[model samples]
Target: MRILLVEDNTALADGLSALLRGSGYAVDVVCDGVSAEAVTATENFDLVILDLNLPDMGGLDVLKGMRARQSKAAVLILTARGATEDRVRGLDLGADDYMSKPFDVSELEARVRVLLRRQAGLRSSAVHYGKVSLDLNSRSFSADGTPIDLPARELGLLELLFLRAGKVVSKEAIMQSLAAFDDDLSANAIEQYVSRLRRRLAPYGLTVKTARGIGYYLDRPTEPA
Candidate 1:
């Protein structure tokens, strides 16, 4: 999963970025609400870990701006403010979840998983399409109930494709989704990943379609019982 972390605390941001990256999440960090708003506007992220107490602008405005532009990315409020009113206000502003400062890293990671699962319409960590299945927790794929081993990047690629099943995903968007703050990926790299993913999924009636001069989309063929 790709995440946008908007926090002003340098230490906290660094720590959380490292932790999330270790967990296989591509994260981009911004120190203020202004950058948060701008990034959320243009970039496609699965989740946003936002701090309400920002330097240039309050995180509330950033959340509001995201909603104003009809962004569907899940927002998780992570700040020192833990009052009921703050929670209610953030929810009303379209936050998917909220966590207070000085929180447990494990709990934060759990909440992030829950929010991501919910956003992807996945009741649990497993996503099923035709005879193909993928377990997010295990980071494993299967075809016809047989285990299929995939590299970390390939697994991430398939996860994104599965979540957006029929929707067209641009190369630029795919690159951003799979890339970490430090990793430099080119368009050809994305094509290679897509090619490998397509081959892996083809036998199970899952196909990745390329739109001329556009992007790719996942297409699932009907499976006979």
Candidate 2:
């Protein structure tokens, strides 16, 4: 999934960005609320990690602008304001979840999973397709009960494909879901990942088909005659 992280602390932003990317998420980071607002207005994101103590604009104002523009992206407020009133206000202003600073990274990851699942209308973290199964929480993939060791980037690509399943996912969308803000992910790199994944899943009776010039989609194996 694509996520926008709005935090001004350079160290914290770098740490969080690394953690989220390692966990198979495409992340873009901005240090101010103005940039956050502009990005949300122009681009699509599955989730937004917003900090209320932004240098330019209040985090609440950014949240309000997104809501006003009818953005459905899940918002998670991350700030040092741990007071009950602050939490209440954030929720009231359309924050889907809130976490105070100095929280554990594991807990933050768990919350992000929940919010993404909720946004995708999914109740389970394990996605099953034909003989393949992937556990997002555990970051494991298996084919016909045999464990498949996929790298982080491949796993992220598979997650996007599985989420859409039969639907055609554009190359741009795939890139957006797997590439970080500063990563130099070219189309050739994407093709390499797709080729590798296609070969890997073929043995499990799944196929990733290219839609000519459009993109790729997962074709589930049919029942035997």
Candidate 3:
């Protein structure tokens, strides 16, 4: 999942960035509310992590802007303000969840997972596609109810494809989704992943069709990969 993090605290931002990265999420950090507002308006993110105490603008203004723009992405407010009024204000402004500072990292991760699962239209953490089933909560997958082991990268690749079946996901999009945000993964890396995914799906009667310079589309053809 991709998340936009708007936090000015360098240490906290860095720590949270590293933590989310370790949890298999691509996160973009902006120190000020101005930049955060811009990204929230333009980028299609799965969620936003907003801090109320910003350097340039108030976090509430950012929330207002996002809600005004009718952004559908989930917003989680993380700030030092723990008052019931503050939390109520945030919720009234459309923040999906609120967490006080110095909170447990596991709680934050759980909230993030819940938001992602809701966005994915899954009642449970596990999502099934054809004979393959992906358990987002456990970070595992199985084919035909049997254990089909996949490396981390391979599992991410499959998750991206299965999450948006029949859609034409560009190479750039795939790279951003599968590669860690700070990782210097090249376009060739995407090609290698695609090839590997195709080979893996071959046994399941699926194919990742290269769209002749456009991108790739995974087709579960009635025939085969």
Candidate 4:
């Protein structure tokens, strides 16, 4: 999932960015609320992590602006302010969840997964797409009732494609979804994974299409049983 993180503190921002990236989330970091609004308005994001304190604009204003424009992406506020009024205002202004600062990254990640899953309409921790099913809670995949063992990275890739099934996802977008900048993408890495997935799904007649100049999409045709 792609997330826009609006944080002003240098250390915390850098740390949070690294942690989220490590978890296979495409994250864009903006230190100011104004920039957060600009980016969130233009790009499609699955989630937004906003810090109430920003250099130029208040984070509440940013949340209010998003609501004013009718953007429905899930938002989680990360702020040091612990007052009940602050929480009430943030939630009242359309923030989906609130987390205080000095937070646990692990807990943040769990919440991120929950919010993203909610967006995808996945109730259980298990997610399915095409002919393959994934146990998100267990980090495993199965096809044709047979278990398919995949490396962690490939599993991450599969999860992403499954979430956005039927839509052509771009290479740049895929790269961003995969990892942080420091883990620079390897040449033909995406192609390799797609090829592997296609081969595995061949028997099921499910397909992953490559739009040559564009990107890839997962499509499956079902027959009456």
Alpha-carbon TM-score of each model against the true structure: 0.87, 0.92, 0.85, 0.77
Estimate the TM-score for candidate 3: 0.85
lDDT of 1 by residue, 42-101 (tens): 888989999999988899999999999999899999999999999999999999898887
Model 3 residue 81 lDDT? 95
Clashes of each: 0, 0, 0, 0
In model 2, the runs with Cα more than 4 Å from the true position are 222-225
lDDT of 3 by residue, 1-225 (tens): 678889999999999998887777778899998998887887777889999999888999999999999998899999999999999999999999999998999999899989888877778888776677788876677777787777667777777777777778887777766654466778788889888888877776667788878788767644444
lDDT tens digits, residues 1-225, model 2?
889999999999999998887777889999998999898998888999999999989899999999999999999999999999999999999999999988998899999999998887789998888878877687678877889988878888888888789999999988877776788989899899999998777777888899999999998765423
List residue ranges in candidate 4 displaced over 4 A: 137-140, 144-157, 166-196, 200-205, 210-216, 221-225
Better model by TM-score: candidate 1 vs candidate 4: 1
Candidate 3 clash pair list: none
| Global Cα lDDT for candidate 1 | 0.87
Predictions ranked by lDDT, top down? 2, 1, 3, 4
Highest-scoring model, lDDT: 2
The digit string of per-residue lDDT tens for model 4 on 9-53 reads 988888888887666566778999889888777666779999998
Shift in Å, residue 61, candidate 2: 1.2
Q: Itemize residue pairs with steric clashes in candidate 4.
A: none
Report every candidate's CA lDDT: 0.87, 0.89, 0.83, 0.80
Angstrom error at residue 112, model 2: 1.0
